[model samples]
Target: MTFIAGWLPSDLNNPSNDNIAGPDSVAIKGPTGGFLVPAGATVSNIGFHSKNAVPAKFSIYAIDFTLLAETGGATTGGAGDELFPLLTDWTPQVDTYVYVAALTSSYLTGIGGDANLRFMPYASRVYEDGFPNPFVQAGTANTPKQALWLDGTLAASGPSIPEADDITDESQPVTFTLSGNENAPTGITINGEVGSNLIFVSENTGAGTETYSYEPPLIADDDTTDLVVSVDGATAATVIAYTNSYDRDQLTHPATEAEYSENSLSYPNAYATTQPYEWKVVTDANASVVTINWNALEADDGFHKDVASYATPVANGSTTVTLGVFVPETGQAYQFDRTITVSDGSVVVTGEGLWCELFRDPTEELFTELFR
Candidate 1:
């Protein structure tokens, strides 16, 4: 949010009104120009100044001459300035003409009968052509004056996120786009977790479109998460995304031959020697139940029938086994194949034995056996 102070002519003074004879009689004065507030801008307060240290009441009107806001009352203290804050914030939808009327006080006669007050509207952001004049005074009596000007400190608007939609894929990382409108956001979070990979697509004077990528943890199907954007430690926008239904295609098995090749059991004693087989299943979705089926292999002792760690007996010849994996979260079953080969002690016993045998028997027959 931006802070715009004194957004109207603060130097303009109300002329003396002798018609306001007493405290009951009021002389209403307005400007001859108006200001245009930007879309989404909010008017927080209006400022008043008295050149003659006189007390007065102010009222703000819209371009249609409708009453929008007003001040209870304000008096120029020793500093000759006071702020009349609104009870509720006001946001104009279209071009608004902020008209301020200074109702005379009993001291009007004491202060040379001149109200001599200046009024300025304070708002968040101003449009490019919001203020048309630097100095504006009252035109006609109670005809809804249009004069406007701005003073005091000026600031840029806050950051914003315009897109708020659900994501389709939970397995893939998501990127959220945000607009740093004049002021860059200090931080961003997803599901209360800090986001990573913050990249700015373009930056110009602290304003640009930035992207934050986040890889969600394993979540259950149809679950939702929130991506919140914050500025100055205040939450500005929140985007919700739901995980899609679990699919069998989303699960992957990253098995390698090296994992099983090093655990091959010796022949003849293959039943006594068990080969450790642990094939992990990787997925971005939660799994309530997981089961592994070791086809054509003798299973050993383990939890859940060796779903995570499988110790199986191997034979002499090479055999292919299809492992069936089931996930209760998806209610689906998947399969993967792995081939195991056991040494019969014909050429070599182990990896060290094979290298030792190669050094002793460096012939074409040994070379062919090694390659085969």
Candidate 2:
């Protein structure tokens, strides 16, 4: 629930605030030599400090030197920290590379000794980048790859939970990795629900990235959760858990179907970015009670809210229900799945709902088109 956005890490040489700093403070901008950006992330802006307001060119390149995104020389200034918006959100698929240079010439210039350029226009929710470094004692500087604090203290500390998760299994092997710390985690939690048993294994059973795995006793009932990893009894890292049943129909929600009532204004969130779809299912009247639950198996599954399986008292052929209607605050899923269970203490039968394209939102008739 917090943003990982901020200035990039300062390449330093010493732990003390005043000491011989690291030699990695400055670098020339180009394809051959530049700061290496951790792969698989989206960046919107670039902020850096300069001696004075000047023009420069910044480009983001792929591992293969493929020019993914580039910007022309503009007001790339100095000292006065300025932020520049990127032309588009850069989603580097893999370990990406960055190239910041002068547009007129590759002659990158003079600036502060402790110069650092961050390709973040706006703040992004931080994923657990590393394990908590042993908290520094008072009067001591932070260690390399240590967690940071913001503003005057008095606040909860740990990794921010992600917006949403796509659960695909019942006993899913949820794992969180600490950067390079070998110490085992003290505890872990998912969606505030703690795990009964934990298995800590190295990235490959050898001395490597510490991956904490949790086989939380989750039921078949659809549940999306968050994983909270505790280091030294203090909240260190938290991530969203895609806690869904492992056993599921491989078939995805059909996108090419006419099951949804498109563009209907009846729903509360129709005009907004997400659209909700409706459907109906049948349950036995003899059953004392019946309830329904759903989950978005894929990232594209449009599930914005959680709609319980229970419907209005129906003793007839069918009951009215909405698909892709309910969603978590995180956002909507374009594809999702549903399961209906009916029981009367004697027998219980579970059925999977038809997976298909439900309502997609943020689409509206244009002003001119409406008149036309």
Candidate 3:
């Protein structure tokens, strides 16, 4: 988050506690910080905090100052000061806790005002369930982290709790690109929270372009780009803000080898790949019943019976799939039956025993030997 401060035209050369008015002490919810007020602005009063989840009130003030115009016979006020534009004093209603007082101008660099431009000290409110506020009591050692408990309530235990979202001003989205090295593989896409995708297309023999698109369109004052990147099955990469684009600075991310490999089968002793095996299956729109037929083959393994029947089929597509089975003493795979539902748009497919599978000998003896 970027920082913005109020400006005024007071010379701080003479440290006089008697000159200022209203609450002299200021508290900030974020981090302790300081800023300078441009000339001519007066220090009025600063306030913070409110009952709303988003505090309705926040402000700051300054004192005795002169607004000197950019063009003037420079008035020398003191040893540590130079002359600037001067103006009269006035007060304006606060808006969204952020207030600015300066000569009206499209640009902020050059302007002067007499009234105090309120500075909203950073403020935040965190509410916990059951608990009245954010602070935790001293005796609650076993309390779940991030969990809220009433002051005198019984200690509760259950699932781990999550903290509330941090409140902050929404940020704007930034457009950026990434250039990959010539040796890098193409077709990479990075995703951002805003539903933007950075696609890497081989534009030339050596480089590609990464573009960003909003998922749900962005709104004004909203943080536009919370960058997220996806590679070939590895954990996604997080891109930094302000860094819109990066030249492939050496290979930091790469595709997984499993994503690039192929599966193969070979004969037992013939040392050749030749097969006339035929496999067939059938099912309704709702995968209620499924049957498979593998044409008879020379039975090398005791499981040459090739009519594979799946009471149920694997519904979800996964690069790696596993079915969990428990054997009391000797661990072994077992079959189970369950109904499954499939949906695409308005169409619905429902079938019973859709996931039942019998794990017998491998279809190929060499394939069976590899696992043993």
Candidate 4:
């Protein structure tokens, strides 16, 4: 088995001369003629060594420019610090050449500052049969030289509206501002729609700013979308927006009683109860009013009653009442149903015989009746 060590400068004697400098810069190294990873070879513990204690972001690419991996951000301890960030092991199906790009923090300043940060890949690989050394020069002296160190900051601001804010009106357009070094933003997508009218204001060696105005599409109420900004084909920032609508789970109604009991035989049978039930729906503050529809109550026996009166009729069997509401903002409707059972006086009399009955009612009323 072959054990490959960390990266080394092409010229081991003049190592200090190869250190690149920048506050925000991209450094690329690789495609070193020989395979960095042979087929079926396993590479692990991919990391880098830093000359300065500074935070940095890294993106790894294949020889064909396919993005392989990325380190969102990592920090070095001090000079000679080796940072082994958490990275998944890689076993390529075919021979591969890996390239790396490092973007140092903008906090770097002079030769001795964080801007003078230098990085070299440190990885271990296991492969059968030794391969050609992948060592290559670090600076501009080589054919595939590193990209010029960009010296500026990357930042984005404003959708004019706050993130995740509910929008009742779609006529109002949102705006965003992207400012940074040259070649900072490659594309911007709003709600999966590409943003148009990209206007660059100021562009110089120091910094540049661009503006993007987006007209939101008509989305179904209660739906959500987002705007994304990309740098070097990678997501840099995002802002989310929501459409005002109702929350079905928040619908409120009167508590349903499992059963209602009646004791007086003088009362009419299968009568509509005078008790009223109110059904209500909840929605975003900016949403429009909801129209409630009280459908007819359904029962196993007895006549169906109009629920528009907000009252349920008492019957010997179970009755189901359905309530529906339409939300104009979302152009959607919701429904809820409840079942109610009523039981008449629990006692029964039979046979042809003169008898006297006495029973206590639900309200503690004593009733005495003669049956024949």
Best by lDDT: 1
lDDT of 1 by residue, 1-372 (tens): 233322333323332322211222111122434444433346666554433455656655554446676656666452444566665666643224454444544311111123442333221111233422314334333323222222122222455665544656544666565654444456656566565544444433233355555554333333456667666555666657665433222122212222222333211111111222222223311111212333312333221221223322333444444433334343333334444333452211122243234245422343334233
Model 3: CA > 4 A from native: 1-4, 7-369
Q: How many residue pairs clash in each candidate?
A: 9, 35, 34, 1
Q: Which parts of model 4 are misplaced by more than 4 Å?
A: 1-12, 15-25, 28-81, 84-168, 179-207, 221-224, 228-237, 244-372
Clashes of 1: 9
Cα-based lDDT for every prediction: 0.39, 0.35, 0.22, 0.35
**TM-scores of all predicted structures:** 0.34, 0.34, 0.19, 0.26
Cα shift from native, residue 275, model 4 (Å): 29
Off by over 4 Å in 1: 1-32, 53-55, 74-79, 92-97, 102-159, 162-372
- Candidate 4 structure quality by residue, lDDT tens digits, 1-372: 222222432223343322222111122223353224433444443344444565666545464446565555677565442434325545554345565445564321212133432332221111123221234333322212222111112112221211223344445655565544235455556566565444444322222344545545543343446666665445645456545332222122112111212221111111112222122223211112111132221221111222223233333444443433333434334344333333361222112111112123312221111111
List the candidate 2 regions with Cα displacement exceeding 4 Å: 1-44, 47-56, 60-69, 72-82, 89-99, 105-182, 201-209, 218-222, 236-372
Candidate 3: minimum summed lDDT over ten consecutive residues — where?
144-153
Error of 1 at 310 (Å): 26
Model 3 CA lDDT for position 133:
20
RMSD of each: 15.9, 20.0, 23.8, 20.1
